[model samples]
Target chain A: MALTDADLVARVLLDDDHHAFAELVRNHQSSVRGVLRQLTRTDVALADDLAQETFLRAYKNIRSFRGEARFSTWLYRIAYNAFRENARKRKELVGIDEEQLQAEQDTRTVDPALRHDLMHALSLLPLHERSAVLLCCQNGLSHDEAARVLDIPLGTVKTNVLRGREKLKRTLAAWGPN
Target chain B: MNEMTEEDVLDRQLLEAAPYIDDNGFAARVVSRLPAVQRQRRSMRGIILVGITALGSAIAYTLSGGGRFVNEGIVRLSNFPIWLLFVFAFGSGLVVGACAVIVAIRKTPEVRNLRRLQS
Candidate 1:
């Protein structure tokens, strides 16, 4: 069997093994990048940059990782913070404009127009609701885990996911067949 | 087969759609940015060893009558003036208090998290 995350963490911590850390980055990069993409409203380049920052921060603070949570959970927390910080900076520079927000949400390059509509509906969600829904639905994190990643209460996470799903359903209802 | 509801169809479509961007060298870019891990570990080990050695020397000095020698030296400086001694004691206390506050701040979770991000 492949080494567990705990084993990889031990190698990185005890042996300062770069290969172990590389394996970690390889394993989790997709999920981390995906979450950031969603959180950043599909700003792929910015998402990738934040993902890189997240991994570097993880490596620097490897010693501080107390292992109380799963390694992935801790990494997600860091990614969430990185995304928030980057978003804050961007907001300060140029407040989120509707046209730019719509552009950022347009990820489907060749898909049908319905896909674009779906993405637009998703983009209409409040940030917390969007993050909560994406973390729980697309990213496959449990509600509790999503709560931890978003640094929100469990009830708030539940409320966001429920409200987000309802909004998506309502917004897409126009396209629904009679 | 059961008839699919509209919500079910939409949910399936959303779930099946690829949500993540394809990793075209993203991992390599991140790995390249990482610091030299072995070198960092070596330097950290050296610092830790030096710290332990310094702490041990200080303890040994205190146990080996260095404490008394320092006390005697301070006593000899008593010839300066009573007010001078009080000012010296207050200055030393302020320095010690500041060092303690710095160490405590470094140990706080928020500071540690900020340091990790900044690093």
Candidate 2:
């Protein structure tokens, strides 16, 4: 059987095991990178850079992870902080060009244009709503987990997710039949 | 399947839009970027050694007459002439200062590495 995340976390803490840590990176890099990509307005390169920083920071601070939440949630918190830090350094987070995002998108997805539209709309969302939706909607984290990752209240996470979905609905409804 | 509701359709769309990203050498790149763990392990071993030595010393000190030795040592030190006391203080300060300098010199590389990583 594959080792559970808790098992992997234990291995990392007990031995500073890089193999275990690498497994963790492999296991969650998709979600971390995907969420970061959406967060960065589909800037895949910057997203990957932040994802790398996330894992490194997690490795340095793994001892503090009490296993109260899933390892992935803890990682989301780190990844989110790394993204926020980068944005803060930039003073303002600007949306990237759509052509770049459209070219980089996986052609395999059904309705690639709709997906592109969604990605663009998500990037245009208020940062809080974008993060909340990406975590709870895109990444499938529970509202409470999203709250923890966002360091926001449960009510606020729910609000952002609801508001974000509503905005998406209205946007899609207006743009229609793509 | 029954037609999906707006909420359900939106949720499905969100999932489809942000499907699992592939590794595509990302994991390898991240793993490669990690700082060498052996250095940290070595430092941890050093800390463990110092802890063990301190613990052993404490056990020995307690097993012996801790208070009596402390009082006697203080009295003996107090009995030294002022010039000798000044010399001892100066020598201790110099030793501490030299050790600090050595430590700072040794740490320069790690500091540089941290700055590089930040960039």
Candidate 3:
């Protein structure tokens, strides 16, 4: 049987086991990176860097993992903070370059026009709304879990998702359902 | 079309179409960047054990009349040249001054900022 997250955590805490930690990195890397890639507007390189920082921070603070929440949820919280901090720094610098954002969206979308429309609609949403929708809808987190990850109230998470969905629907109505 | 149902359909479609990137050694990359695991702090049990042993030793020494020996040794040392006392004081001051300088250098904002940028 595969080791539970708690089991791996115990190994890391008690024995300072790198191998166990490596297993954890392998297990959760995809979701963490996926969330970041979306959060960073498909800036894969920056997302990967933030993901690395998240894991490193998690390792440094592993002893503080008191099993209060699911390990993945805790990890998501760290990833969110890393993304927010990097976003703040980037905002302080030159702000996000429009061309760069378009280029990133271009690479990820399969149907250029439709994907571009959807991406544009998503980009129009406020950051918190975008994050709440992504976490709850795309990332398959419940509203409660999304709230925990975003460090916002449960009602706010629901409101963001509702408002975000409504906005996307209105924006995409011209395209209609394929 | 009912507004609520139309919006729900769009939400479902968007969720199902969410992009997922392949890992492709991402985990290995993160593991490579992790700093070495720091040494865990000493446990409370170990600290308590050491404290108990130290207290027990001190109590045993006191009960065994070891204080007389310490007093006699101090008396003999006191009889030595007064200049020797000054030398000892100066040496102690030098050691403390060096330690303070080292700590100050480590605590400087530049050093801390450099470390932060590196990490």
Candidate 4:
């Protein structure tokens, strides 16, 4: 059987063995980086810097891992907290304008028009709503799990998913459902 | 199968289109720095321990020879076994050494806890 995450993390912490950590990082890099990219949309360089910083912080703090949640969930919490700190430091509040949202919508060349509408709808959303939607829809997390990672209530997670979907439906209608 | 709603379709696209970035030896770099940091911490612990050892021996000798006060209790306690004292000193030194190394080698609070837990 493959080494469980807990076992691997224990090894990483006590032994300073990067073998297990490398496995974890390799497996989750895309998902973790996707979250960073979504949060820091305009700054690729800053996003990359923050992504590395998040892993470094997580490794540094891994010994405090009490196994209160799944390791992936704990890692997500770290990423979320790190992103929030960077946002606060940079004063980069997400006040997404419709025009800029439309421009972001138009920049994607590869996605279908419907996909673009959905992405546009997501861009237009308030930051927390967008995050909840992406974590639930894109990342395939349950509302409860997303709420745990976001440290919000389960009800709020459900509400955000519902409202986010409804907004996407309206946006797709405007784009005429290709 | 459940229907893929607009949100679902969009999310699928997002994941498919997402870019991957590597951390580039971040873990190795951090680990590399640990030993030197640990060594520095170990020596500091050693100094404190040495000081404590020297102080304890001086106090024992001072009391044994002729302390300023002729307290009877002081006289008896000072008559501790030389063998026992040697053992105690050795044990204390070992403890001080372990503590010194532990303090020096640990990188984070979590790592420190990990060491204690592992032990």
Q: What is the C-alpha lDDT of each candidate?
A: 0.75, 0.80, 0.76, 0.69
Q: Can you give the lDDT of residue A140 in candidate 1? A: 64
What is the C-alpha lDDT profile of model 2 across A1-178, one tens digit per residue?
8977777776776566788988999999998998998888779889999999999999888767766677789999999999989998987555434454345332324343888778766776677888999888887899999999999999999998998888777666656665
DockQ category of candidate 4: incorrect
lDDT by residue (B30-117, candidate 2, tens digit) is 7787777766778899999999999999987897777578888889999899999999999999999999988986654433333332
Task: Report the number of the highest-lDDT candidate.
Answer: 2
| Clashes found in each candidate (C-alpha, N, C closer than 3 A) | 0, 0, 0, 2
2 against 3, candidate with superior DockQ: 2
Write the residue-wise lDDT of candidate 3 on B1-119 in tens digits.
Answer: 69778766766766666655566887777677766655434466688889999999899789869877778878988998999988988999999999999998765533333333233
DockQ of each: 0.15, 0.22, 0.16, 0.17
Index of the highest-DockQ prediction: 2
So what's the TM-score on candidate 3? Answer: 0.63
Question: Per-residue lDDT tens digits of candidate 1, residues B1-119?
Answer: 33236545655655554354566777778778888758776789999999999999899788968778777886799778989889999999999999999988765544344433333
Q: Chain A TM-score, candidate 3?
A: 0.80
How displaced is residue A13 in candidate 4, in Å? 3.1
Worst 10 residues of 1 chain A by lDDT: A103-112
> What value does the lDDT take at residue A176 in candidate 4?
70
* Tens-digit per-residue lDDT, A1-178, candidate 4: 7876766777776566667776667666667777777767536677666766777777778766767566777777788888888888878665566676567556744345554545555666667777888788777787888998889999999998887767666666666735
- Candidate 3 wrong stretches, greater than 4 Å: A92-124, B1-12, B38-119
DockQ of prediction 4: 0.17
